[model samples]
Target chain A: MRHLLTTQGLPRDEAIAILDVAEDMAAVGEREVKKLPTLRGKTVINLFFEDSTRTRISFEAAAKRLSADVINFAAKGSSVSKGENLKDTAQTLAAMGADAVVVRHWASGAPKTLADSGWIDAGIVNAGDGTHEHPTQALLDAFTIRRRLHGSASRGRDLDGVSVTIVGDIVHSRVARSNVWLLTTLGAKVTLVAPATLLPVNLSGWPVDVSFDLDHAIAQGPDVIMMLRVQGERMAAAFFPNAREYSKQWGLNDERMRALPASSMVMHPGPMNRGLEISAAAADSPQSTVLDQVRNGVSVRMSVLYHLLSGAVER
Target chain B: MSVRTVLQHADITRALTRISHEILESNRGSDDLVILGIPTRGVTLANRISAIIESVDSAVIPAGALDVTMYRDDLAQNPTRPTRPTDIPHGGIDGKTVVLVDDVLYSGRTIRAALDALGDLGRPRAVRLAVLVDRGHREFPIRADFVGKNLPSSMEERINVRLEEIDGVDEVTIG
Candidate 1:
């Protein structure tokens, strides 16, 4: 509970607790005030070392809704551009008396570094840390899935025995990585579907079945079908033959979308590639949880902040 | 520690029966009356009271639970308290008489938080407080409208209200 750096080692009870708390946070969002006095007089700094508008905004909204004073510090054009390292920046944030820090860094273990380092006494949350983990994203995805599956009675429940088939770029997907650990922890049977080129070299240790065919996986009629965005920026090394070929082989097109059961959930952690990773029809389909994922991100982050800062755990 | 049972199961039933009658009398036969309990044991008490009123008056009164953990002021002292779900009745609390139910009325801070929580949800026409036991330590200028038993006790004493719905017993004990 000290820091939510990753979902890898998060206990099942704690995961359910977070989801339950997120349910409460989601209720607050439905209220006329849409704000809580929970984290009042606390300062939460959104320290972004990488540009992620969606995540930064979600964290900011979560903090704001909890009535926490927020300080946004993007590392692009700040003193970071003038060679101020993480330790120095953290020390600066520490001096400002930050109660919590939601950090998204390009480095894999940057949030852990911030938490482990003695520079700051604030609760450090991994907004995202490169390809290592995006715990909240995975949490929100899980929240959305739980809500879709169980509706109003999803409190204190894990995604037990549900089948989820995650499609597309697993090698560069922190979303996929987070889901792989979290879903498996929640007792969901996960099958990762990706082209061999886009998959990580080692899946032997991971708790998931690997399949290269999206159509074949769709034929199984899993409860949830999550389509990951093909990270084009990371594809500089020719991960696939081309976009059209990749779409042809692994994309969630209309035909592939129609093959799934009506009860199946289509999820994407957006900014979705409409025609590349998922077609427009599938993206806008009734089965899609793209918007729900974004909406739940705020609640999930609120629960994360509340868990991390409410107890004010020692570093 | 000396433990004394202030109210037994039958005594609780009698008090709740009287409280239900008082509520029906005050509200004039349960028209637009929404009974909301401040979670945990309050919910059980609310349900019992609601059921009693329904049986006696032959009219259904909506009952629900309101969780005020987010609106609390004691997060600095004890912050790790998990929130219970807030379920307002389907007709909602707007323009209705809301009788806030709880097991014990102590520091009155919980009621204050519940008031805040209620304001965010919807505006009730009138709000009243009801408690199974009013162990008067009132830190705030608040008092319960309907009380099952007003057991005057010291600040050092702990009041425990156990119900069959949750704790497999119906007893109010002070130690």
Candidate 2:
């Protein structure tokens, strides 16, 4: 509860509680005045060692909406570029009175180090770490799914019996990793569909079914089909034959889109490879929860910050 | 801790009935009336009073919940209070008679925070306070327009209000 470093071992009750609070935060967003004085006079620092504008801004919006003062500490131009370490950077921010720190780092377990090192007393929220976890992304995705399936009456409910098929870039996607742990914890059956090279080697530890064929996974009629963005920069070598060949086999093209049931949801953690991982037709379809995930991101981050900063006294 | 039942279930019903009559008499009718309750127990009491007013005058008054957790002055002192949803009735609070209701009014700080929260929503023609139990220990200059019971108690004592809608019982207790 003190820090939202990872969703890997987050308890069911605590996860449900965060989702329920996010529902309340979403209600506030629906009002004419979409602002709360919950964290007024408190400071939140967006400490990013990696460049993720979407996540940084989402946390900024969430903090500003909650009436907290925000400071965007991009590691690009700051003292971090001059070789200042995370310990010094965090302590410096803490000295400036940061109540919470939302961090996205290039190194895996960077957020956990910042939180447990105790160099600073601020609450740590992992925006994303290198191929490790993006807890808030998983939370927002869950929120979007729960809202779509159950609507306003989604409180106290888990994704029990729901089938989720995550496609593409399983080895390099923190989103896929986070979702696998969280969704399975919430009682959903997960299946990871990717090329053999694109997937991790040791799959026996994960609580999910692995598949090398996207068409067969689609034919099974999953309740949710999440398309992960293929990071071209991260793939130093060729993971697949070509973009066209990958699209023909594994991409959610017009043909694969038609194969999906109408009740099924299409999702993507954005900056999507429109033709590589998912087609424009599928991304723009009404079944796509992509925009819902973005909108819910703000509320989910608000709920996380609320629990970390505002809910501290109650604990 | 020793507990005392200050008001029984029947007592709460009668008190609400009397308060409903008082509100109806004061406003001359239910028109332009909106009863907004603070979250937890006050919202249930507001709905009950609204239903009684509907039965008596055949006028349906909108009842909603106003959560003041964000507007409290003591947030820094205790920063982890869970926030509830603030649902204003349809048509907004502008130019309406907003009667703020709560289970117990003790330090008046909650009322003060409620007033601040209401100010952000809209400008009401008139804002009144109503409470089921009014324990006198006012830290702020505020008073309830309609009170169910004026129970005088020490600051150490806690007033608990339980409604059948939420707690499966209706009674007021002081412990």
Candidate 3:
């Protein structure tokens, strides 16, 4: 509860409590006045070393909706761009009385450092730290899934017995890793699908079904099909043969989109390469909860900020 | 056969008048007041209090109904119909002093969940809990600062608070 750096070690009830609170936050979102006083008078700072429009704006919106004074500290134009160290910047934010720091950094474990360091007496929320974890995104995705499958009445409930297949770019995807840990914790069966290179090196110890064949994984009739954006930058000299081949073998195309079960949902942590990781048809398909996931991101983040700031002191 | 007329309707009305005066006196005349009623029966009670407060101060207080069903921790264990949406009259509650009105206070979980729900609506300047009956069986150490009646009840007996506006009855019944 203190710093949601990684969902890997989170207890099932703790993770579910976040989702449950996010469910209540979702109910608040549906109201005429979509802002809460839970984190009132609290100051939330978005410390972003990485360029992320969605995560930054989502945190900003969430903090603002909760009546928390939001300060967006983009490293692009700030002292961070001038090689100012993270400790100094964190200390400065601490001096500014930041109640919570939502951090997205290029280096993995940056949030862990911020949380562990005594430089700031603020709650640390890892928006995304390199390819390590994006807890809030996973929470929002879970919230979206819970709402779509279980309906509004099913808020505060876990995705128990649900099956999800996360396809593409598992090696460098914080979203995939976070989702695997969180969904599994919430009582869902997760299957990670990717090529040998795109797959993480040591996922055998992870509690999830790993598959190489996209068609075979699709045949399992998963409740959710999450397509990770194949980062061309993350691809080494040669991870996959090419984008075209990857699309043919792994990317969701119109044919595969049509073949998915009627109850199945399609999702993508976006800036999707239209025809590469997911076809336009599938990304914009009727079963796509991608847009809802983005919308729920605000509420999920609001819940996180509220819990970290207002709840009983997190250990 | 029935013992009636202990506290008459007029006496209850006068008590409400006195409670309204006390509320205004304590809250400093409702300058930045927003009354929110916990749902089912609390809304009616809130309406009555809002009317009384408005009558005395010539100020309109924004009142709303909050259904804490979705936010309740024991929702899964307790089988009940789904709660309706919260109806806040204003656009939102960015900087208002929200006085939450409830029929009875038992275990403070409802208010705790309501606080969670209120956090979603907007940040209030302050949230004050006001209840008609403060029945002390608090599992979560929650208490109402303002109370209409301090009725002590046991765990087995349930307090049913009915208001005339909605239930057409103005009495507190122990079941």
- All candidates: TM-score of chain A: 0.98, 0.98, 0.96
Encode model 2's per-residue lDDT on A225-276: one tens digit a residue: 9999988878999999899998998899999999999999999999888888
lDDT of 1 by residue, A7-38 (tens): 89999889889999999899888877899888
Q: What is the DockQ of each candidate?
A: 0.64, 0.53, 0.10
For this target, which candidate reaches the highest DockQ against the unseen true structure?
1
Q: What is the lDDT of residue B115 in candidate 2?
A: 91
lDDT of 3 by residue, B110-170 (tens): 8999898788667988888888778898988677878877877778776776667776767
Question: Comparing 1 and 3 by TM-score, which wins?
Answer: 1
lDDT of 1: 0.92
lDDT of 3: 0.81
Q: What lDDT would each prediction earn against the true structure?
A: 0.92, 0.92, 0.81
lDDT of 3 by residue, A213-310 (tens): 99888888899999999887765678878778999999999988878898899998787899998999898878998889888898788777765766
Chain B TM-score of candidate 1 stands at 0.98
Model 3 residue runs over 4 Å out of place are: A312-315, B1-101, B105-175
Docking class of 2: medium
Least accurate stretch of 10 residues (summed lDDT) in model 2 chain A?
A306-315
TM-score (C-alpha, index-matched) for candidate 3 = 0.72
